[model samples]
Target: MTLTDVLDDWPLWGISKQPISANQISILEGGLTNRCYQLSLESGEYIIRISAANTAELGIDRNVEKTIHQLVSSLNFTSAIRYCDDENRYLIRDYIEGEVLSDNVEDMSHNTLSYMVEQLKALHQVPVEIDLPVVNISEKAEAYWQMLATQQPNNEILKMKPLMQVAMSEPPAGDFCLCHLDPVLANWLYTAEGLQLLDWEYAGLAHPLWDLAALFQGIKHSFQQLEKKSKKNSHSEIEQNLENKILTLYGVSDLVAWRRACMQMEYLSSLWYQAQAKKDSY
Candidate 1:
């Protein structure tokens, strides 16, 4: 179905609707599992997100996502959901006017870092009334591996299975709290109001450290991209400096956090690639 067809039946939540023209709708990038677009109207700008098919295979529960959006919007940490359609798997939200953060650590100022840490701490403290799924990295990875094997056996995935097992054997110690499983830089926006986190589809109850680890992995991935483009070893140094800064900000020792981050990074990357392969096969 076309976007217009979807919007024709959208519950606008009392907002006045204008003639939505092609010029007024622009596709937004960065989402891997959803189609995002910015819709401009005489009333205001908004974001319409359409979930991709078969996302359930990746452990995304749209019902859980709706609950998360409501909770975070109430806390003013995310954009307010103007309307949601559970059956259609689409939602309209107030468009946040701000700069979407870059993954580069150098681009992140000390103030931004502090703000990020504060927001994350607050997110972890929110009271969750509904029972959210726990993110078990090892089990998730193994599940993905098995799924991928059915399509076409991957030797690399098989080899990584043993390592994933070893990594999970000595799991990090931390309280299970609400976490944004995918906090990569693109999901963060710095606005006049404050720092707002977008895309809560992957949000769930897990080790608070997992959030930190996801952030670290995101920064490291950004540096890796830079290293590939510039062929400079300086990117590695910058990544290490950022890691040290993160460790200091969180008051965690380098040993425990880094190890946990590495393990989570591996599991996340493996699952991500397998998911991509699965999607492509479909």
Candidate 2:
């Protein structure tokens, strides 16, 4: 179906009368697997997210997202789901009125960071009854490497396989928790109420540090800022500042476990870049 057809059929949106005012439909950029539009309506604005090509290949499930949005909306850590398709694919959510933390980090004060951390902690605190897919870091790293292997071999890319071997050799000690597997800066909204996290396509039950590591990996900060901002209660100074903050927020005591999780995420992300490069080259 066409994008408009999909929108009109959305059960949650209740869109009728052919979208009378559509001039304000602006594309919100910056994601490889989804094209999001800020769709302004006569009643209110809604965020319409359409999964891009091969989303299934990347392990996305819209049903899972619907379940998660329902679960977390109960905890008040995220925006409520307005509508979704039968496949848990296309979703329309209440347009969270705030700036993405990435768009205005300088505007975010210390209070903002505390609020963001609390929201993450709330997500981690959710009970584990839901049988979400486990995002096994080591296995994901392997898939990433296999994707990379299809590309022009770089020494750094080749090193990932060895890294995966080492990472998988030992198991982390803690049981997995509810994790927002992709906690990049853009996914978080800093509003007056605090930080409201968005997008659950990558949500899963996984190691807690994985989210923090992913967030820290994407934040554009220098080493000096990293040192000054690192939390004192974190397991080690080696963990990135954001990861350290997350660990501190969650009261994590095992520094080694966090390190291993971060390593796995780093390997997985590198592999993704390599795979994308190979695809572009062809």
Candidate 3:
């Protein structure tokens, strides 16, 4: 539950038989649902992630995550999970030394782009051998809204309520697959083991397009932020070409539905951030 607790209980973590000093642990940037620490053990380095409280209330199912993660790990699409807690309190994985795909996402070589898309394609095809839960877009949005409502939401948050409703009104994508649901650029890494998606809390059975929508939107956001910082005009055409290539490569012909899913993904992302901001207890 706390850094002190983790350090004090090191032997129980399935890391090493030997004890480790406090100086061996250092904080690392983490995702929305957990606090991360990199432990430099004598054998090697590892990442110990302490999950946030009330994960179930935030639409995260640790059991489902574990099952799906094991499947992905087998395919070499994610970091090797060295030790997973029985109570879902913490996870220890080998520390991956590599770069995220965020900066080069907008201008990756053609072969690199294809390889990335191929990885995503392969993930979507993973068999639903285990009984995994399907994602409920509407319910998830409402759950986030309820949490946010208690926080004295501001004007921006208030306005998102309606926009979220609008996004929810659209029909769901026709197909389902084992989707990562959060394939944003930062989650992707090019480690020696190869490309891997680090975060697994949001993974579940969802539309194939949900991952795509998240991916493209992530690229657009990264480029826009960079453009603003550099004081350059935003290049909408680059975004268009990227989308076109993905559409053609992934065989997604329904532009209307794809665009709709992208919009809904944006609103859903906004709601999750506001809700998490108010409730995150690390």
Candidate 4:
């Protein structure tokens, strides 16, 4: 269905028959499994997210997402939700005015990293009253691998099995807390108010270190990309500094254990994207 059709049936924050002009709506980029659009009106700017098909197969529950959004909004960590349709899987929230951080970790300043760490600490402290599931990286990776095998049936993909098995052998040592499983650079917005996190599709109770590991993995990946393009190991200093700060903030002194956890999480992330790609192709 078109945006117009969806909006027409939208409860619209209690405004009946709200007229939305075509020019007022602009599509937003980078939503891998959903359609995001920025809707401008005299009322204010808002974001409307339409869920993708078969997202349930990936373990995303719209109801849980809505609950998590509401809880996070109450903590002032996320944008305000104006309306949500559980049945249709459409969500409307106030648009955040800020710059989405670049995927390159070298672009992140010390101040930005500090702010992100602070926000993460606060998020991890949030009490878990909601029935959020604890994220099991090994299980998720295995499930994705199975799905991909059915879809593509390739050797390269099968190669991940042994690696995943090894990663699962040694579990990360950390307490379970509310964690944003996917905190990629795009999901963070830097604003005048502070750093705001967006997208909670994978939010749940998981190892507190999982989020920190994800951040480190992002920086490492960005550094590798830079090296590939420049034929030099650039951005190593910045990446190391950021990693040190994150480790200090999270109180993780065991570098080897930390790196192992990050590697496991990164592997799970790889499997997830591969599965998503296969699903999209079908």
Find the 10 residues in a row with the least total lDDT in model 1.
10-19
Q: Per-residue CA lDDT of candidate 4, range 1-282, in tens?
A: 456667786455653346677888899988887889998877788898888875766767777778888999988899988887648568789999998875545667777777887788889999888787777776667677777888878748687687667657566775788988777777898889988999998888887677888877766676778789898876777666777788887678877778777777878788788888757521
Q: Where is model 4 poorest over a 10-residue stretch in terms of lDDT?
A: 9-18
Best candidate, TM-score-wise?
A: 3
Q: Which runs in model 1 stand beyond 4 Å of their true positions? A: 11-13, 103-105, 159-170
Please give the lDDT score at residue 248 for candidate 1.
Answer: 76
User: How do the residues 97-159 of candidate 3 rate in per-residue lDDT, one tens digit apiece?
Assistant: 888888576566666667777888999988888888778788778878877877755536676
Better of 3 and 4 by lDDT: 3
The best candidate by lDDT is 3
Selected candidate, larger lDDT, 1 vs 2: 1
Model 1 C-alpha lDDT per residue in residues 1-282, reported as the tens digit of each score? 358766676445455455467887899987777888998877789998887765665666788888888888999989898888758578889999998887445577767877787788789999888877877776656656665766667546566667667767555776688888778888899889888999998788887777877887886787787778888777666677777777678777647756775677667766767756657421
Off by over 4 Å in 2: 8-12, 149-166, 169-171, 220-247, 278-282
**Model 4: clashing residue pairs?**
none
Any idea what lDDT model 1 has?
0.76
True-structure RMSD for candidate 1: 2.6
Q: Give model 4 RMSD, 1 decimal.
A: 2.5
Of 1 and 4, the candidate ahead on TM-score is 4
